[model samples]
Target: MALKAPSFLADAMLGSVARKLRIFGFDTLYIAHAHDDEILKMGIDQGRAILTADKELFKRVVKAGARGVLVSGAGDLEDLVHILSKSGVTSVDLGGIGSRCSVCNGLLEEKNQEQLKNGVPGKVAEQHREFYQCMDCGKVYWEGGHLRRIRALAESVDAKLGRAVAT
Candidate 1:
């Protein structure tokens, strides 16, 4: 049987990490308002590994026989590297083709420029030929400076993983 890619349930404190994970095409559920018990229950029920910075919550997760990762990194970059490493992702997929919506964890579907209608500013539509819309939230995305930064971070992650960055 083929191994499934790891999915995650991140706690309120790890929103940034969750967004980065979604950007990297991982399935992540960010529970910002749920109680610890609710988060734990959802994580186990959905078969998602819990990502948390709370020591007590991690302990509870382990005690309940749920898979969990204790994230205590200095920043999102470090936490992301650690999480990806733990999930056995040796290389990052820097291509934005399969990325999820950072805001809602929804799948992104590529859309033609004309299909965007009033979703994007006129200047953005004129400059960028490619576009993606969140299938769940309808948020529009295009290649921009943020994408460059994500690529650079992916390169750094690649180097740290001892893998050559894919062009």
Candidate 2:
């Protein structure tokens, strides 16, 4: 059987980290105001590894037959990404494929130039023809200069893990 990509349930404390995971096309769920117990339950129910800064929460969930990561600090997103990447808790699939939405966890749909004219800024719509939209949240996305920044950050985390930009 093929191994599936690891899914994650990020606690409220790691909201920014969750966003970065989603930006990398990981199936990360972020519950902004979730209680510790609720977050643990979500991880159990969804079979998702829990990522939290709270050590106690990590201990609690890991004891309950779930995998988790206890983040050291909340200073930087890049650090968090590096820690998680090194832990081998999640695999980063970096082919720039449509996997997850940065805004919402919904799957992304490829959209052509004509489809994005009304959604994005005039400059972006005119300049970039290729685009993708999130089905659940209707947010538009495209490969812009920011993608290069994200790729650089991922490379900084793991040179081999930065495959998302090869597309």
Candidate of highest lDDT = 1
TM-score of every candidate relative to the true structure:
0.91, 0.83
**5 in model 1: Cα distance from truth in Å?**
1.4
**Please, what's the RMSD in Å of model 2?**
4.5
Q: Model 2 reaches what TM-score against the true structure?
A: 0.83
Model 1, 1-167: lDDT tens digits are: 03567899999999988888888788999998989999999999999999999999999999999988999957877787777777667767666424799899999999998898999999998899999999999999889998777778777876776542232
How do the residues 63-94 of candidate 2 rate in per-residue lDDT, one tens digit apiece? 89887777766554554554555445344455
Please give the lDDT score for candidate 1. 0.85
Residue 105, model 1: lDDT of 92
**lDDT of candidate model 2 versus the reference:** 0.73
Candidate 2 displacement at residue 81 in angstroms: 4.6
The ten-residue window of minimal lDDT in model 1 covers 158-167
